[model samples]
Target: MRFKLSTVVLPSVLLLGSACIVEAPGGTSPEQRRAATVTQIPPLSVRNGANLGRKVELVAATVQPGRLTPGERATVTVYFKVLEALEEDYLIFVHVEDVGGRMERMNVDHKPAGGLLPTSQWKPGETVKDEFSIYIPSNESPKALNIWLGLWDPRTDSRLALTNPDQVRNDGRNRILLAQVPVAQ
Candidate 1:
């Protein structure tokens, strides 16, 4: 049976003290990114963590109606494109953590559209869109939650490579912290 989309509530955020991230002196140039190996990603199986996600880039990740209440549902939309052809299907991973680094969160792991659309169907250089609803747990009190997004292959339980290693958490799990979701009491 295929793995269903489910929320695994972990006790607390993994607080690895913030590390400084350095960007290009001026800005990202196509020539620079291509040189970094981000513009061309290889298949997941033969991939290396050091390569990061230079090939398939996550363009925009937004939480509609950004604020959430206990037990409420919110829509999350993501826009991304593959700079090169991808040969394997990948999963979307979402993790909601408190801004204070305290309290628990719901981490979601599943395929697109509840196991319908797979990343393998993505065409090179074509932008792909994905949307889904996330239900905030009623058990916890209201707080600001950071919504982190990333891609992983369920078959091997491995996270896709990322480009920036300093600004985000590089747990070797390939997660990218995308946005902040305010939980109102």
Candidate 2:
């Protein structure tokens, strides 16, 4: 019996071609691969006032390796300033998101700017240095990580001009600052 080339070799060639495609280890599908890639990045770190807006300005950011256990965690430090002095109350948001869609919020103090700068009312000439330490999980699959910082203006009872269009607008709203940091292992 003679074997036809089309019938015998075609299927073998196709099977070998498909096998050459690399797949992620441990049953990670294509979608999971893409998601993993997105999560490997570290959080953003701003270094200058130019990256900030009128309301909340980014002074600087720093990070250090905290623990190297099952899940990697890094202590992130950030500095910011609030322009203009207002009697209204405000809240700052700092957070980190991992590749697996896990997010963690950083603890920050918005009162008595002692560790920061300019404890009194936010003045034009005065500068504030607010710091926050954030932890990033090690199970993040070594992908891109996202970090965000926002300023919420709770001055509903008072009428004060809020700076930073991205954080707050003239319509009496709030705004936030965004930063992207790349991570590698």
Q: Quick one: best lDDT, which candidate?
A: 1
What value of lDDT does candidate 1 attain over all alpha carbons? 0.53
Off by over 4 Å in 2: 1-45, 48-56, 65-73, 99-120, 154-178
Q: Name the 10 consecutive residues with the lowest summed lDDT in model 2.
A: 9-18
The residue ranges of model 1 lying beyond 4 angstroms of the native Cα positions read 1-52, 113-116, 166-173
For each candidate, give its TM-score against the true structure. Answer: 0.63, 0.45
lDDT tens per residue, model 2, 13-55: 0000000112233443454323222211223443534223344
TM-score of 2: 0.45
Q: Write the per-residue lDDT of candidate 1 for residues 32-89, one digit (tens) a residue.
A: 3443222333221111122235667676544545457676566665556667766677
